[model samples]
Structure formats: structure tokens, C-alpha cells
Target chain A: MVPLSWYLALSAVLFTLGAVGVFLKRNIISMLLCLELMLNAANLAFIAFSSFFGQVEGQLFVFLVMTVAAAEAGVGLAIVIAVFRNRETLDVDESNLLKL
Target chain B: MTFEQILFILFAGIVVGGAASVLLQRNPLYSAFSLITTFVGLACLYVTLKAQFLGVVQIVVYAGAIMMLFVFVIMLLNIRDEDTAVDPNRFLVYLTIPLGAILLGALLYVVTKVNLAQPTGDEGGTVERIGTNLLTKYLLPFEATSVLILMAVVGALHLAKREKE
Candidate 1:
């Protein structure tokens, strides 16, 4: 059987990769994709702990997290659509009217 | 050495590789496709964790529904590969290298220290057990999530609605 630490290490690696992607990616949609990556990494950790502790709470939390992710995706994509409609671009740096 | 370990490595490799592709892909459509692979790999990982219900839900909700929405938006926007914008805060990209290394190291240190005794056999993960818990102990939060979903639907409808001329 694989040790719990290995699962956790993978989760850590994934989360770091997502964080770095968020920092480096210029596209708003890619940033959103990275956000989903981070969420999945967290869900992986929760499930690993749930199985390790033999508790359902962590699984339940993951359920809630999934629910939230669904909601976030809906609203986030809507915002993306609206932004693209107005700005005619999906680039985060190009939509810097607020900085002006 | 074991089947489960091999499966873990395979799925983990797919997940990590897909996620990296998602970040590296210049086209949002390609990134969305890569994200689907990542989600599917995570679903397999969930099943291996014995959370069969979540594994199914991860596929249905994330890979099926959410990713479809992503691909739909990417197509609707007609985002091409060359549309990728220049990074104004280019220095932040370099800064993330050190910060992410520190973050990963800290998380690994903390998790490696968890040496709890192996869990004795518990009730195997089942829809019945999860459903019962959802209705009994977690009913309120479950209900709240419905409201949250409703709000999201309404908000998306409003936000994406065509503005009156």
C-alpha cells in the first residue's frame, strides 16, 4: 500500500504548480484554470485525510468544496464572457482600465 | 511494487502532466482540454481513495459539466493562440519560483510528520453512508448549497444576458 505521505506530497506539488501558474499566466481563463487546479489539489488532500482517519467529514467537506467550485465556475465564466464582450480581449494585463 | 501504487503513479503522472499542459498551452481551448484530463485523473484518484460517489461526482460535475462550459466559452470567444497577452508584472513570475518552493517544502514537512496508526477497517465508503450523513448531520449545509447554486444560476443568467440597446 502506498503511504499517506506520498499522496500528500503529490498534493503539495500540484498546489505549488497551480500557484505558480496563477502568477505566471496572463490569460484570465488560464488563471481560472489554475484556480481549478488548486481546488483539485486541496480536494486530493481532503480525501487522503478522510481515508487515513476513516472519517466521512473530510469527504463531506470535499463535497461542499465541489459545490462551491461549481458555483464559482458558473459565475466566473459569466464574468469572463462579459469581460470579453466589453474589452474584446481575454488578457488580464490588457484589461487594466482600473489601474488608469 | 503493488497494483495500487502503480495506479497511483499513473494517475498522478496524468494529473501533474495535464495540469502543466493547461498552464503551458497558449490557446484557452487547449488549456480547457488539458484541464479535462486533469479532472479525469483526479476522479480516478478519488475512486482509489474508496470514495466512489465523489469519484463519480468529480467526473459528472467537473469533467462533464464545468469543462464543457469552459470549452463552450473558449469557442464562443474565439480565442486564438496568438491572443495571449504580455505580462506587465513579469517580475512576479520570477518571484513565484522561490515562494512556491518554500510553500511546497513546508507542506511536505508538515504532512510527512503525520505518523498516525493505520486506520482500522471502517465502514467502507458507500452512497448510503454518505447520504445518511448528508441528510442527518449535514442537512443544513447541503440545503445551503442548493441556495448557493440557485444564486449562481441567477447571477450567471443576469451577467450573461444581452444588454438592451
Candidate 2:
């Protein structure tokens, strides 16, 4: 049987990749994609733990998280589109009008 | 190794490999395609973890809906070949190596310390059990999630609508 630690390790690696992507990628859309990756990594961990403990709570939590993630994606992409319309560029460095 | 182990290995490879490609690919379209593979691998992993409902939801919400939105936006944006770039700073590029190593080290340490006792594998982790838990123990999260969805709808509309000139 595959060990739970293995799953956790994989989740951690994926999460790190996503986090790094968020920090390094300049494109707004790519950054949003990275955020989704991070959310999925967390969901993977939660389900792994729930199954390891033989409880259904974690699965239910995953469902809740999925709902939130979908909503976040919608709002985030709309913002990206709106910003692109005005700025004519999705580069993160160019989106500094709001920076204080 | 058994069939489950082999499957786990394959899915793990797909998830990690696809994610790396997503980060490394120069074309945004290619990155989006790679993200789909990552999502599919994750959905399979969810199934192996006995969260059948969650697995289906992952596929439906992430692979089916969210990814489509991503692709749509990419196409709508019409990002040309001249738009992309690899970051130029050597210092920043090198920093990722050590940072990633440290994060991986911390994760490995925590994983080693935890004692994850395997399930007795008797009771099926059924959808009925999940439904009951959502109504009972997880009612608050369930309600909060609906609110989150509502907020998302409003926020998306606000974002998409043109500001009053």
C-alpha cells in the first residue's frame, strides 16, 4: 500500500511549485493559475488525511473548498480581463497604478 | 509493488511533471494545457484517497469549468509571441533553488515526525457518510461556502462591468 507520507510529500512539492509561480511569474493570468494549483495541492492533503483517518469530514471540507475555489477563479479572471482592457498589458510589473 | 502502488506512482509523476511543465513552458497556452494534466492527476489522487465525491467535484469544478475559463481568457487576450519573457535577474533566479530546497526540507521533516496510522479499511467511506457530516458537523462551512459563491458572483459582475464614466 502507498504510504500517506508519500501523498503529503507530493502535495507539498506541488504547493511549493505553485507558490513559486505566484512569486515569480509576471503574467496576471499565470499567477491566477498558480493560485488554483496551490488550492488543489491543499485539497489533496486534506483528502489524504481524511482517508488516512477513515473520516468523512475532510471530504466534506474538500467540497466546501472547491466551491470557494470556483468562485475565486471567476472573480479573479474577471478582474484580469478588466485590467487588461484598461492597461493593454497583463504584466505584473506594469500594474503598479494601485501601489502605494 | 501492487497495482495501486503503480497507479499512485504514475499519477504522482503526472501531477509533478505537468506542474513543472506549466511553470517552465514559455507559451501561456502550453502552460494552461499542462495545468489540465495536473488537475486530472489530482482528481485521480482524490479517488485513491477514498473521497469519491470530492474526486468528481475536482474534475467538474477544476478541469471542466475553471480550466475552460482560463483557456477562454487566454484566447480572448490574444497574447502574441512577443509578449512572453524569462525573468532576467540571476540573483532572483538562484534564490528559488534555495527557497525551494528549504521548503522541501521543512515538509520532509514534518512528514517524518507525524505518525499516520493506516485505516482499518473496513467501513466504506461512503457518500451518505459525507452528506450526513456536512449537515451535522460541517454545517457552518457548508453555509459559509454558499456565501462565498454569492460573493464571487457579485464580485465577478462588478469586475466585469464597466465603471461609470
TM-score of 2: 0.93
Give the alpha carbon lDDT tens digit for every residue of A1-100 in model 1: 8788888988998898899888888888889889999999999999988988899988898999999999999999999999999988887877888894
Question: What is the per-residue lDDT of model 1 for residues B51-119, given as tens digits with 9 covering 90 to 100?
Answer: 899999999999998889888887888675655654655888778889988998999999898765437
The two-chain DockQ for each candidate, comma-separated, is: 0.73, 0.70
Query: Which residue pairs show backbone clashes in model 2?
Result: none
Q: For residues B16-82, write the lDDT of model 2, one tens digit per residue.
A: 9999988888788789999999999998998887777777777888899989999998998967554
After superposing the true interface residues, what Cα RMSD does each candidate give? Answer: 1.4, 1.5
Error of 1 at B122 (Å): 2.0
Chain B TM-score by candidate, in order shown = 0.91, 0.89
In terms of lDDT, the poorest run of 10 residues in model 1 chain B is B80-89
Chain A accuracy as TM-score for every candidate: 0.97, 0.96
- What is the lDDT for A6 in model 1? 83
The lDDT of model 1 is 0.88
Q: State the lDDT at B84 in candidate 1.
A: 69
